[model samples]
Structure formats: structure tokens, C-alpha cells
Target: MSSYTKLRVAIEKPFGKDLSSAIELADSILGNLNSKEVFLIDHYLHKPGVSQIVEFCRSNPLLYSSAGLIDHIEIISSESIDVRGRTDYYDQYGVIRDMIQNHLTEILTLLTLDLSNLTSPSNRPFDLNAAKFDILKSIYPPFLQSAVFGQYSGYQDDLESDKGGNAHVNISTTPTLAIVVLHLQSPVWFNIPVIMVSGKKLGKRETIAKVVFKKTRHVSLRKKNGYCDDIVFTIQDSNGSSFITLPSNHNFNLPNDKTWTYNEGDGTSCSSMKTIPLGRMALKETYASVLRSLIRGESDLFVPLSNVLESWRIWSSLLLEYEEGKGEHLMIYNKSFLDNLRLTLNGSTLTVFVNSSDPQDNLVSFEKDGISFKSGNKTVEKIKEKIFGHFLYKFSRSSLAREISQDILDTAITSVQARDSFHLALPGGSSPADVYQSLVVDYKHSFPWTHTSIWQTDERCVPITSRDSNLFQLSKTLLAQVGVPYVNIHPLFPVCHKSESVLNEYASINYFDYVLLGVGKDGHTASLFPDSVNSSFSPFDNNETVKFVKLPLDYPIKVKERVTLSMERLVKARRIGMIITGKDKCHLAHVIESKDKHNSSLPFVQLLRKAKPGTVKIWMDRNICKK
Candidate 1:
């Protein structure tokens, strides 16, 4: 007998009210297992549920089967008034009834029994068909008066079938009805049965319990059972047939009689059969076969596993990157390190650590043989002159400005056209007001405005009409002038009206193709103010496309609740443009343009660092150059 001793049950409710009731029901049923302890988890709280279940299973190891137990139950309740005018709240249960009847437990028990039987082979070339028939006969004795199979059409159907093969059996018991299919020719042959054992309405079709099995050949018998030789398994399922092959040298282990043990040399072992959704199982099996071919050796496994492992690593890195106060550290890293970083693609926003500091002034660029940090600056006066020359004269030229502006516009247009639908996060404040106007005028005549959607980069908690609200400026400058339909424009609703819902609704749309922003003297852009309550605009560590922030600021013009597209969305954009003008902004611009890592303290530094290569273009005027 297996020394398993823990019971863990997971229950789901179709509605919130039924959650507690389902838990109560599960506890009652689990009580019958005679385990020392029972753990009932409610799925509504996903993380807590999984953690608690895992913890309970880990703590109690002797009362339940070694194999884990997961129970899913859904309950739907309704109420109605009868013809007599009396109102009644009727509780209707569907899958919940299946759970209470211990259907899952029974299925798991049967699976365990089947697995145990496969491990020890019979000496007399066990007739797979005969074995199935014998088991059925013993379980459903036809001569016994109280036998559950007495009323069912058993062997007659097998005899009358045109196939002339006894491959099917239908059984009806007090609490269950099922049809079992048996395949004798396959090495991996098992009874695939669809059982319906619920008290509620049967609905249109029968609920099923599908059992699948595969046989492993080339059984390797080793002293220590280290690794198995390539084994071919014939998979038999309710829907169809397939095959699974494991690498000959792949290291895998199965639980031994008293403890978990790994096979040393060549050994035969069955792969753990996972009961997943039919579609997923099919896909996994197909992929498994491909993996068997791909894994050449221990070193080769690293190639594929690396891809998988990198995904988790990226998540961990992102979490560390976004952890409060770690932004500065992430921004200090060089480009090569950032490029090799991996990240998961779950359609959620990802927090990126950007080195907002200028890359040109770094010690490596200055002292390194190949690159020089400052080509024109040997003294303070020369450095100041170069800053003034570049920011004042070079950046302000109409020719250069127009080139960058056109690049931004062209990229935005191309991206929107490619995606069919695109959103634009128009930042609030006077800085983007002119850019928005320019885009409106330029694109109105050259592009299809109808296909484009617009959202504010950030909004004040005040009404949309408020002067400080980004939506107000955008509406007056661009959205009001564009030919796009009203549905194409998503404006953040004022805080009084329900800001969260409004933000969520806007976030549901695809990320913007272009986000035009302006640099502030303090290095702040959009509504992202450093050390402000609105600083919540920081990119999320996950894959969400947008974020709503409530940044706090000391400056009157900067303080406000805002919603901004996350950095993940910004990086994902086809293009992003940062427009910088005015002499007061020169210091910040120069900081970002410099190679000093200290400059990363600026927010824009972070933005530039996190941006995908070639996606971001900084537009500046000579007047903004630092002297």
C-alpha cells in the first residue's frame, strides 16, 4: 500500500455567495478519507489557495495518496416566485453535485489503481483484452442479485457488434452510468470510460471521465535506475491514438516503495500521465515527441530548458528591477546587459529599468581606446561651449527638427496602419499641446484618422474640462479637430465619476503606436514626477499595457492624480518622441545625453534606457543646451 497521507481539495464557485458553501461541502466529503488532516481551498483567492493547498499537502504526508488531489466544483444559485405569489430562493447545483458525490476522488483512486497494476507485469503474456474483461466481470457480477451491472447490457453488445470485437461495454449503476471502450491490439490498452454520476439535470450531453494510458517499451532494467533508454509508448485515449517517446538518457525518477529514487543506468519507467484539457494534452504530447528528438544530450537539454528557464529568470529580474528603490540600480547597467535580458510575454505591462543618464560621458567612453567620452571638451569652458553649441545651434535647426519630427510621424503612421487599430497616449500639460496640434494638422490630410484611437498619457483628478487635465488640452488641440469618430477617443473620466473604471476601460484597448512627450526642467515627462504621489506611473513589472498613477509633487503644476501608459507600453510602441525646448531644460537634456551614470536619477534617463533600440528619438532645440 502507498504511504500517501495528505488530502487537499480545491473548490471553485460560479458565484461569490456559493464559495463558502462549496468549501463546507468539500470539507464534509474529505472527512470520509480518514486522513489526519484535510485542506479545503477556495479558488477565488488564487495565490493564497495554491499556497495553502501546497503547504497542507507538504505537511501531512501519510493520510492521503502520494499523488496530489485537486477538486473543482462550481455552484449556481437562482431565485423565483411561484404562481401562488410566494417567493423562493432555490439553490441549483451542477458540477457541485459531482464533487459532493466524490466523483473526482473515485477517478483519482481508479487512476492510482491502474498505475499500480501497470508497474508489475503478469508472467503469462497478459492478454490486455482478457485482463479488462476479467476486471469488469469481477466488479460487476451478473449473477449476484445486488450486483450493480445486473441490469446493464454487458457481453451481448460485444457479441452483436459488426466489428466482431468485444471492445465496448455500457454499465449502469445506482449513482453512475458509463460507456467503456477497450483496445486490445495496442501495447498501451486501457478502458476509456465516460461516466455521468451527478444528481442535477443532465443537460444536453453526458459529462465524461476520460482515462488514457501509454505503454513503455525498451524497458531498461538498471541497478540504480539512473536514466532510461529511449522508450516508445502507445497512447490510448477516448478521442484518438498517439505515441510518446522519452529520451534514452533523460534523467527522470519515480517514487520507490519507501522513498523517491532515481535509476542509474538504462531503465524502464512510465512518464507521468497528466490529466489536462483535451486540447492542451494533445498539444503537450505533440511537443513532447518533438522534445525527445531535440534533446541530443545533457548539454542539449540546456538549449530548450534555457529558453524555459530564461522566462522565469526574466520575471524574477523584472520583479527585482521594479522593486521599490531599485530603479536607479537597473538604469546604471550598459546596453549589452539589457539586450540579453529575457522577459515573459503575457500581454501585461513590464517594468523596465532605464538608465536615464546620458551614455556619452561615461568613464569607459572617455578613457577607453576605441571611444572618447568628450571629443570637444578638454576643460570646463570647452565643455560649456560644446553644450551651448549643440543644444543652442545644432538641435534648434529647422532641418534637423523637421527630420526627427517627420521620422516620428512616419513611424506612427506606419505602425497604426499595420495594426489596423492604434491608441495614442496624449500627455497632459502645455508641453505636448503643440505636438498634438502638429500631429492633428499633419495627419488629418495624410492619414486615415478613423482607424486611430487616442488616450491621455495622464489626467488630473479634476474634471475633463479642467485646464490641468491632459484630456482637456488634447480635446481642444487634436481630438476636437480630428475626423476620427468619438468612439475612437478614450478620455479619462474625472475622479468624481469613477476614475478606476474609466482607466481600466481605456487600458483594455491596444497600446499606443506613438506617445509624444515633452521633457520638463526637472527631467520629469508626462505626469511622471519623481518622488511624487503620481510617480506611480513607473512601468509595471508584468506585461500590462497601461498604468494609472497618483503621483504627489511639491510643484503646483506637477501635483495631480494621473494615468499614464506604462513603460512596457511605451517600449512596445512603434515610436516614441521626446520634444525638448527652452534653455531651462538644457541641464536635464545634457544629463540624459551625458555618459555619467549619476544622470540616471532623472526620469527621462530611465525612459531612454528602457526604450527598444531605434524606437525612441529625442528632439531638442539649441536653446535647451546646458552651458
Candidate 2:
């Protein structure tokens, strides 16, 4: 770029792997050249089908104006073939980086762009980037809870075969398929989930952007749980036809369906549009279109550096997480997984598809309620117990530490084996110090500290060196001796405001593998005091994963201010162990469980009610049972 004064250079896809790198790369280029001289290329934007998505809406403006009524949007890209030839490249950049970060994000900007401010597409370079930038700025980062990743059953074989026959390879966690849900912060599109799904192998080769409107009030449509007719932009079809699909009941619509397809045509009237014959569209050649735009200095189609950086910011944590071998478990899927998959989002409920590649056993689907299996395996059933319902284990004081430590180890090892990582959250205070000590003394050598991340469940707002600090106690008892990498230890910052970033970081963790909690005599867990309800310190009933609490000066606690995980967040763990040791605390736990409506306000009771049926396992000393 520095070589010429007024030359336009087309940078390729994937400007950088993450936000910092994107900024660095952009600065290096823009320092020598102005913004207009740089054209960031993403060929998907130039595809005639993708381009027409904007045109179709521009022609029919009601769809864009009624954006608030839309339920959700889905941008789907599926491939029938595996990444055999591109194995090397595919290994480095998984589905999210290869597709969702660039191609799908560009399509999203076009589909949801606010065109009301701009008069025409003719005003390209300035108008388009501004509109896209607005949408990008309004988007929240992708949350791990709303994502599902999968790899084909034989992906490892493909990787080895691509290398020499004798090549050694570790089991790869790289996902060939991923479905991630993104939310928009813009009031016009508030709270609507923009679902981006892309995957290779086991599905038809199809690329489409589907806009599903909210369910109508009409009795017939509501009875069928159907929403307003979906407007689908078919970027590529099995037969290579590209068209915008409109709802139609006529025989001429589709081969055996009811949808009128419109292809690219120069006409002010919608009737003038006609579908092109399959595999015969001049606009299908995206590379030619992009190159033509680059040479002609038409910067409208090119991605700007701002868009690249924003997209990177949205996906940077996920990319960094996986690169560090800390990501959601990559589900092994059979060849027919995608073919049998069905996704339905109705009202506030979404049903997700889950499939397993186990040859001897078959797992079906996962709904909001729980996982469904066609056949049962002993091991699978045991694991399911740890996730779905509540169980109580009463152990003597002697066995409490040993048993809980073993349980923690079991979960950590299982998580590492499945996802190459484990995330654990621990509560503070003197109650569970023995458990922490047992973990370090007995199982430190066997634990996968290298692939584990330790998070504080709650912390006193005092300095880290203070005696009241949770990190100080944790370090003294467990963390210092475990030999876990310093990078894996996540401490809640003493500065309450600084710890809010934990929510963003936690967004990339699917679930804490195991969370060790303690209930006080006041029926509070994780620094969530009973009397703090409705105060600024109340961490209940919010969407935040981490919260800051500041008690009044007269409060009895030594350190009045604190940072804690919300009850909503604590329930997201795969397993929750409540360790109640003292007689007074154990009595409070029983009273909380016994009193039905009267104890409803208690945080411990609230946790039991909010948690999945089998997820909360109470581990108590034998004294509770004896009493």
C-alpha cells in the first residue's frame, strides 16, 4: 500500500485472527494509505444472491421497516463434502473463522442494515460502510451457551490420511460444523437472535438466509405454531441456482413446493423477475465480480477495516479459547446427523438437535427440557444423572473431603477428555478449605491443571493480599500447590468495576464443569447475603454472569463490598456441590429444604428451584442425618 499514492489494494479474507491483530494490521496498512485506498475483499458479498438480499428488501421496504416484528433470522451454509483437500487450512481455521466471521457476518449486515437513512445504493463507499458499521456496533458478542459444535465421525482419519499414512496425530477438537446465536443490541432489532449456522459433511450443499417473522395472531397459523411466511435468500442451491424465494401456493413455484423464486433482473416491477435456469447465471461467478469491482474502484462491495475489526471482536474470545484448547466439547456426529436434524424456534422456546456418533448407541435430540435418547447406555445414564436432577450425598466428616475431591476430579477429567479443557468455580471461606487441600494433596499429579481454568465463585472486594480475600485463601490452600498455570487461574479483581469483564469472558465458556458452593447459616451462598435483596448487591434475577455488591457501612460483615457470580450463572454449571459442614449451617440447609413457600426468598432455596432437577448434589456431614 505504501508503494503507490493512489492505488487501491484488495486485501484477502481473514484480515486477522483477533481484535488486537486486526487493529495492528489495519494500522500498518492505513498509516501508508487512506481508507479509500484500501479494499478489504470478502467475495461472498459480491455473490449476486447475497447482493440481491439488500435489493429485494430495498424494493419491498415494509420488511425492513417492520424489523421489530421479526422473530429471528437464520443464515445457513452447509456442505455435503468434508474438508479433505483443505485439511491443513481447515485445521488452522475452524468453521467459525472460515465462514461465520466473514461471509455470514457480511450477509447479516446486509440483511439487517437500516436503509431508511440512505436514499440509494448508488451512494456506495460512504453510505454502505456507515450503515454496516451501525449494525456491527449494535451487536453483542456470541455467547457459548447459544452455540453447538460438531465434528464428523471420521475427521481424525481424514486428517491422518491427508498427511502420510504413518503420520502421528492427536485427537482434533477442530469443529467442522458450528451453529452460533448472536443478539442485536439495537432497539429496532432488540433481543432477536440472529442464528448463524455453517458446517461441512452430511448435509446438502446449500447457502440461504432465512428471515422468520413473528407468529401471526391468526387462529389457523397460531394453531400450527407457524410464523409469518419466511423470506429466504437462496445464495446457492444444490443445482447452482441463486434466487430470492417468496411464499407462493401456485404449481409453478417449486418442483413440489409452494414458493416463487426471483432471480437477478433489471426491472422496477417485481413481476419482471424470473428464475434463471439451474447452473446458468452470469452473476454466479463471485470472484470475477469482486475483481471487476476492485479494478473499477467500486469500494461498495469491499469490507472496510472497521467491519473486520468488529467481526474479530465478536469472535476473538472464542478463537483464542479454542486455540488455547479451552472450548466446548466437539460432538462427534454421524453422516446422517445433519440430514435428520430439525431446528424449530417458536415463541420463546427453541428446540435444538443433538446427535451422537456412538455406533452401539444412538442419542436423539436435546430440547429445553432435557436430552432424549433412543437407547440407553449405562455410562450415558450415569452421566445424565449428574446434569439433569438433584441428588443428596451425606458423608461423615472424615469422608467429606475425600469423596468431594474425587467427584471434582472425575468431572474435571471427563470434561478435559471431551473438550480438551475443564473450567471449575470454587466458593470462598473456611468451610471447604479441607476439600481444596484434599484435591491438591491427593490428586494434584493426576489432575489436568494444564487444561483446567479455576474461577472464583465470589470474592471479597478487599485487596488480593488481604486476609478477607478469597483468592488469598484459595492460594494459601489449593492454587499455590496445584501447579496450575498462572494463565488458567482467573481471579476476581478487587476493583468491582474491573471484574465486570468476567461476564464477557464467561460468555465463551459453555459451562463450569463443576462448581463447589457453601451455604451459610443465613442461607446465603457465594457471598450473596440474604438481606441484600433489592439492594445494589442483589445478584439474583439478572442476566449478568458476574456482579458487584457493596454493603452499607453498618453491615456486620468485615468486608462490606464483594463480587459474586449471579444465581443465574451458578445454575449453568454441569454439577453443583453444596458443602455444608457446621451444625448451624447444616440445620439451615434442612430448614430451607423443608419450608416450601415460606423459604422461597432464601438464595439457597432459589438455587434449588432454578437448578436442573439432578444438577444440585448436596454433600453434608453425617450429623445432619443423625439429628
Q: Pick the candidate with the highest lDDT.
A: 2
Against the unseen true structure, what C-alpha lDDT does each candidate score? 0.36, 0.69
Q: Write the per-residue lDDT of candidate 1 for residues 129-240, one digit (tens) a residue.
A: 2222223222210010001110112223322242344366332121111111111111122212212122221221112222211222111111123222222221222333
What range of 10 consecutive residues in model 1 has the weakest lDDT sum? 141-150
Clashing pairs in 2: 388-614, 389-613, 389-614, 389-615, 390-613, 390-614
* Candidate 2 residue lDDT tens string, 31-138: 988887888989887776787766665665555576666778888898888987678888878899899999998999899888675466464333777788888876
Error of 2 at 248 (Å): 2.7
- The TM-scores, one per candidate, come to 0.35, 0.58
Among these predicted structures, which one has the highest TM-score? Answer: 2
